[model samples]
Target chain A: MKNMTMGLAALALLAVSGVAQGADDDHRLDDAWKAAVEDNEGVLSPAQVSGLNILAYESAVARLCDGIKLDEKKFAASVAAVVTGGSALSEEEQVQRLTAVMFQLGTANGLFLAEGAMKKDTFCAHAAEEKADKDNPHNWQ
Target chain B: MKFSRTGLACMLSFGLLALPPLHSPSHAGKTADAIAAGLVGAAIVAAASRHHKHHKRMYYDSYEPYPDNGYDTYWNNVYSPAAGITCYRAQVACYKANGHFSAKWTRMQFADGE
Candidate 1:
């Protein structure tokens, strides 16, 4: 009877510890999600808002390999590379770097959409180039 | 034969001189060889005087993911993102891997209400 009682007490202690750890994780997830939005404010287009929100949720996953951790090196490199790939040009080097970052965020969001877990809203911004050309005939000349 | 009319007088004299002596045919062949060498030298000099030239066009990487039109080439000139806190913050951390935050995170946040 005494041994069973001891086991029950230990089980209770472990359950409490598990709950505490889960709460800590929830806090981190919230922090990471806020960080993602904070990092990506004006950059995400209206179409990508949905994807970012989804990734924002993934930030909550406690495991490293599973979701996009706002604080991991691999994620950072991937972000930098995507940004480098999507980077825009600017007269100011600093401004140019920011442009590159926009590309990174946009491209990253696009990738997450491709994963099949997230559905993207069709944004008209994709047609900006077409509209610009349609409106300006002299552009081709 | 209109030797004079054809202006072969000087050429005929040279030919006669070029002929091997009736006594030594070998000497006649030597003179013909010298005349042939002189003509070849003149041809070589003419060819060396002429020249050939060429020009190459310029090419560059396309900035567009997939270009729909000709203007795609020019897009690379302006490839950059909007200057934001995230970029500034990320770059700071890039310089120093761990939390060496030079650029404040709040400074670059998107102005759009999230």
Candidate 2:
């Protein structure tokens, strides 16, 4: 009876710690996003910044969820079109701009995936709900 | 006539040389016409290839999913649940308004929503 009681207490402790850790991770992500916005202020438009966030979240879902696939080529082409101003920008300018945007996206994606890994069950549930929604555009197929 | 072998050879050579040159003015004109025709064909092919390439580039530029006309704010806002709409739906509306809907966009909208 004592051993069973001890086991239950340990499980409860672990569950509380997991919840606390998840909250901490969420805060970290929030701070990281705020920092990203501050760092890119004036350099990137608000839309571009928001696009990066959306891309990161979708990428995380795509990576961790089953039956979801990202069309990387099409996504990259669309991103290139936007960054290059519909191919109006010079090659050098496009390269510079794309590099910057990709770096930001990479950072955000890394953070999102790291956080998602910790609470995979919850994250994937949310991801599945989002994917099932007809109106969501990230298009994880 | 019983001509010698050497004499026969010389006559044949002279007879061959006496005929009109293969590149007569008329023949040269025909050759030039062929060359001109070939050039025109090549030019047409090149122009068609260029047009195809330009059309592809324009298609990408036109159909890509970037926000315009202040839709960027909407895009940013939709990420939050407070917006009461998913980003995907917002994007569909945005693309439709801007006439940027491609076949893929059309299919997605048809499969998912009105």
Candidate 3:
């Protein structure tokens, strides 16, 4: 009986450790994305850099939520789509993109992008899947 | 699609306005400076008016994002290609509305002439 109890505790510890390790793995994805942005040679104003950082961070979150299993094939396909479809925003799209990211993130959580925000439908139906920054990769943010 | 005559004209006028002024032969007199200022001012008003008129025609406030039916180097340099994204998944709204329009316009921005 004593040994069984010890085994259970050990299992719990392992599970908790797994969760922490998983979240840390997600951070690696975020860091890689940040590095990519920094690697980008495109000239940007301070404001633009800030905006891009927010977007990239949020986007990385979204991608993580979308799936952490990204390998070579998915990465290539996703890049092709964005490269092919992205608005290539004009000077104005910068503001709009930030706003959109906020809205999408806000709506995904039951509450807006503020405190007390939950995965409820008051904001949007797709909120359940958009957990971009919520430590959950399956969310809609 | 090609830039319409109106779009071309608008781009040219604004393009010139965006360019830096030519070096003055000499900055000796107030009159010379005023003349130069007037040229720039006229350019501003024309460009501003055109900007207003052009935007007024479309609902830019709710304007959707571009769809990438094709590719463009400039955009790639700016917004690097996505990881697994095949079509531009810009706005949830725009993509939900007309996925096709987004793609065509995207390619045009790249293929469209200067």
Candidate whose DockQ is highest: 3
Model 3 docking tier (incorrect/acceptable/medium/high): incorrect
| TM accuracy, model 2 | 0.42
Highest TM-score against the true fold, candidate: 2
TM-scores of chain A across the candidates, in order, are 0.23, 0.65, 0.25
Per-residue lDDT tens digits for candidate 2, residues A1-141, read 999999999998886554322222232343344344322232234355455545556666678877777666545543433343434534333333333455556666776677578767766766666667666666366
- Model 2 has a DockQ score of 0.01
Q: Please, what are the lDDT tens digits per residue for candidate 3 over residues B23-84? A: 44552243344334333432332244335533221122332222232212212322213321
What is the alpha-carbon lDDT for the whole of candidate 1? 0.26
B23-67 per-residue lDDT for model 1 (tens digits): 245643543443333334222222222221110000013111212
Measured as a fraction from 0 to 1, the native contacts recovered by model 2 come to 0.00
Any runs in candidate 2 off by more than 4 Å, and if so which?
A: A1-28, A86-95, B1-114
What tens-digit string does per-residue lDDT give for candidate 2 at B7-54? 322322223112112266876565444334332423332244334533
To one decimal, what is the Cα RMSD in angstroms of model 1 from the true structure? 32.8
Predictions ranked by lDDT, top down?
Answer: 2, 3, 1
True contacts kept of each: 0.00, 0.00, 0.00
**Model 1 stretches with alpha carbons more than 4 Å out:** A1-71, A81-94, A118-141, B1-114
